[model samples]
Every structure is written in C-alpha cells, then in structure tokens.
Target: MKKIIALLFGALLLLADTEFAEPKPSIDNPRKIVFPITHGDDESINHVLSSANNVMKFYGPEKVMIAIICYSKGIRTLLKKEKKIAARVRSLMTYDVEFIACGNTMRTKNIKKEDLIEGVEIVTAGIVELVERDLKGWIYIRP
Candidate 1:
C-alpha cells in the first residue's frame, strides 16, 4: 500500500510539471487571451489586471497576445481620472497588451476620447468585440 501511495504521489508531481501541449506558444503562434472588465470598482479592476499580469508572467510576454475589453462601468478603468489604475494599464501596455473601450459606453457616459488613457482603442461595442474574438478562437477570461 505504501508503494502504491508513493507511486501516485510521484505521478501527481510529474503531471504538475508537464509541459504545455503542441503548437506550444511562441511569438508567431501565441496564445490569444481576452479579458473583459465590466465592473468599475477598484477591487474588480485590480483583480483583473493582476490576473492578466500573472498570465503574462507565466507565459512570457512574447508567447501570448492579450486584450482587455472594458465597457459599461468598467470603462472607468481606461479613464485618465482613474490615475493609479490608468498608470497600471499603461504599464501593461508597455508589454503590448491591447486595451479596448466601448464606444457606446462613452456615448452614454458623455465621455470623449480625450477622457481616456492615451493608448486605449475604441470599439463600437465591447460585447460584440468579445463575441467576435471568441469566434476567432481567443480564450475569454473574466476575473
């Protein structure tokens, strides 16, 4: 029984150390990930940003393509007024993370392009962008 238990433990450790599957993320065949932020609260925003950073660290920036889509109240994350959070977003952008804001949300909130952080891209609808990216095989993660 002890031998069997020891073997199982070894197997578990081996599995934990197993490498990622074929096509194995690379600059050309990068893992595509999209993170959607729909809540404006600082906690939620920070959580999502942390999640993205963790992923980037695990995969190495060169092996992954990351996009963050913000809409509704979440649009606040991309606003210049967000200050600290906006700075964090800009820091991630330095590693090539793409940040997108919903145009509809801007119209509803009466926010203008100049109101957002310098590099955020504007999309007509954040949800639609999520859907299209999902269809194109991008992994969608909501943290």
Candidate 2:
C-alpha cells in the first residue's frame, strides 16, 4: 500500500510539472524567440548572432521569428560604426531577423537613428520588451 501511495504521489508531481512546463517550439506555428544583449564584447555579440542563425537554419527562416534586443553597452552591436560585424548583421537581416535598439540607452549614450544600422528599430526599453515577449510565450535567450 505504501509503495502504491508513493507511486501515486510521484505521478501527481509529474502531472503538475507538465501543467506549468515552458512552452515548446511548434513546427506548424511560427517559433518566436527574443534575445536580450547587454554586453558589448564581440564574443557575446557573435554568440547571439550564431544562435539566431542556427535556429533559423534548423527551422527555415520563414518558420522562425527572431528578435535581438540591445541595451546598455550592447547597443554598440547595432551601431553604424560596427564595421567588423556589420556584414554579419546585414546577412542576418536578409533572413528577416529584427535588431532592436533601446531608446533609453541611445539617449544616455547619445545615439541617434542615423547612428544605427538602417533596419534597426528603436524600442523605449529593452528589459520591458524582453519581459513582455517572455510573458507572451516567446523563448528568451541570452548569450
């Protein structure tokens, strides 16, 4: 009787975990991903791009929607002067990946729209955008 009771409890816990499990990507539906970048280093920026590239490759560009949000020092990754990585950025854009620049960081860092890459979008706050996307069931990745 005790063994049966323990097994029942274990089953209940498994059921509970599934009830609150994180959302999984669906091939039939558009896979949503939001990556928040707060570091300005080349290594960090490259990782973010590589992850997005891998996901798009795996899912096919049309099947996945990717957004990379930059704030703090990370905003440098989207600047027009980021020559070292500009080509890579443009390459990702061809896959329809979005690059978001935080307006608050731009203001503090004195970055204008012209200072950013042509396709970059400006959002009021990066953290808030990440939070909203996560709550909406989008996968969040930071590298």
TM-score of each predicted structure versus truth: 0.89, 0.80
CA displacement after TM-score superposition, residue 88 of candidate 2 (Å) = 1.0
**Candidate 1: tens digits of C-alpha lDDT, residues 96-132:** 9999999999999999999999999999999999999
Count clashing residue pairs per candidate: 0, 0
lDDT for every model? 0.96, 0.88
Clash pairs detected, candidate 2: none
Whole-structure CA lDDT of model 2: 0.88
The number of the candidate with the highest lDDT is 1
- Name the Cα RMSD for model 1: 3.2
How does residue 116 of candidate 1 score in lDDT? 95
